[model samples]
Target: MADFTYVSTWRGFVYVAFIIDVFAGYIVGWRVSSSMETTFVLDALEQALWARQPSGTVHHSDKGSQYVSLAYTQRLKEAGLLASTGSTGDSYDNAMAESINGLYKAEVIHRKSWKNRTEVELATLTWVDWYNNRRLLERLGHIPPAEAEKLIMLPSETMIWQPEFTDKTLSRKPGAVQTGFTRHAVSWGVCHPNIYYFHNLTPGWVSFNGEKPEIAIVPQSLHRLIYGPDKRSSPSLDDDLVVNLCTSEHLLVHHPMLEGILLSECERLKQHSLANKLISLFRQFGGTELRLKLVWLCWLDLMTGNSLDDWTKNLKHKSEKDLEQWIIARQGQSEPLTNLMDQYVLMAYRTSVDAAHS
Candidate 1:
């Protein structure tokens, strides 16, 4: 469903169109504009189209002129969507979109006095991120829209919020220029016990995007400690300590594990500012040799002995897309990841007790 609401700005009243998924109550697409022009609404629809690429869906909206516009109807038909408008003066037909608009107004618009379109735009971006990923909905079992989406095996859809708008951005007037690609990426190289785990067991989790050559940053956390939130300069590093990850297999396995402990400990101490040197270098492309060398390292919870930050599973995955489906199907309905690892220990205890009693 789609709807537009007016936002108060010093320049004038800006209009924001929101298109949300009814099933998960996830805001799929949104655009802030100076006017409620047909082009602005089309921009919102474009965002939704590329982000999700849904096949068989209904595009429902109120009996507004924009919704009934010829251009809008043509676009909907081209996308193979059935356009449905509510009967004249029927309020309930577009209640879902109205409900979302009401929340967007009360929560964000009413909270601040805006100066211009840019302020409202930035604020909306932040609020939408939180709303989809963090805000809980009572109807969705108190889970965020993202969690609810995963539970229902909905295809994960993410709108890349670019700092600058591309050719897709609509100006207040017609025939405005908008143009861009998502360029920012981080590569993490992990050290797993079984280097070929992705190749043999969970191949689906890996994508072969040989974008860059192997750039090793041993004790991966070092990258994050430096370039991550806490920026720190590194002293002259020892080549032997870094090369040992290749020559000395033992160091390769244990060194990253030690770093993992340090990272976890940093959070435990809550004095990250004092220990800013430790950071994570956490992005990488899937490859043949790297997969063999990559290791998964973690500090185990004393009670459970299960590797903290590690997911235990026995399965074969074919591609990155397949792994996404697997996660949605198997793990989405399970208890979410928790900061405290004691939950796994309790789970183990209960399973043993149930088995012994049976």
Candidate 2:
């Protein structure tokens, strides 16, 4: 879908609209556009009707001007399909379609940097194919829509097992007990010595046998004492300590000395101010990597520079393309730059020094 959009950019701004079958969740019709004109949506709807040839199906949508247009209405009437528009502000009416748009934004547009419309169109084609044939649908029981439909067409039978349990007896012993409810005897093994026993206490229950149950009971107030609030949710030593140790050892082996380097670099960057020099260096390098490195360098530089203070504080108000342009400009170039990484680092160091004094 992104590729389609990119390719369409060669001509002008374009939007790709599709009519997906609610039952099968397959895109039955889609059309690319250089404009949001009614024709684009109408063409898409026509394609959908022609492909599906549905005798009668509810064509549901929000009260978008395009869908409400005379030409769009005529096409639906001629095809004998019901045109249903949800209330003006009700999102539920067109939630499924909206979700499709959200998915396209998150999974495709968010991830890539496209040069043109042609690229967007091509990417869109690949995305659509994967979505239809490969993507799993939770609504369809974690099966792809096409596969789930196939299964539904051919019914099958299989056996399923379920287990049920009930208490057989309840008895107590003499003063081996501690209280009316003997702490030790209340346990399954102590209460019913002959029967196979199991612990059926609630999650926070405590036991103090010669073999201590591997459960820690920490008071809510004292939670910070052991793990602190942030680390409290982490697995305790009793929970898979061996597995945790093994994972730690494996990580160390796989990336030997990486942690030390990371720590040293962090400490060094913290003490060193290189904000202006970093930004200038980034401007010199100009590219994706250079852009990111510039951002980091800029942070350090800002820490030391009075003039460049809070430069990006209002960045949230900027458009995405504007932000990209700003990043590119900081690198002192734009896309299609060469030897970007080295240039970026050098420029960053220089800029940081300049900004610090300025």
Identify the candidate with maximal lDDT.
1
> How close is every model to the real structure, measured as TM-score?
0.43, 0.40
Model 1 misplaced regions, further than 4 Å: 154-358
Best by TM-score: 1
Per-candidate Cα lDDT values, in order, are 0.47, 0.42
The lDDT of model 1 is 0.47
Which ranges of candidate 2 are over 4 A from the true structure?
A: 1-12, 155-358
Put down candidate 1 lDDT per residue, 198-218, tens digits, no spaces.
Answer: 111100001012222121222
Q: What is the lDDT for 192 in model 2?
A: 25
Give the range where candidate 1 is weakest over 10 consecutive residues by summed lDDT.
179-188
C-alpha positional error of residue 71 in candidate 1 after TM-score superposition, expressed in Å: 0.7
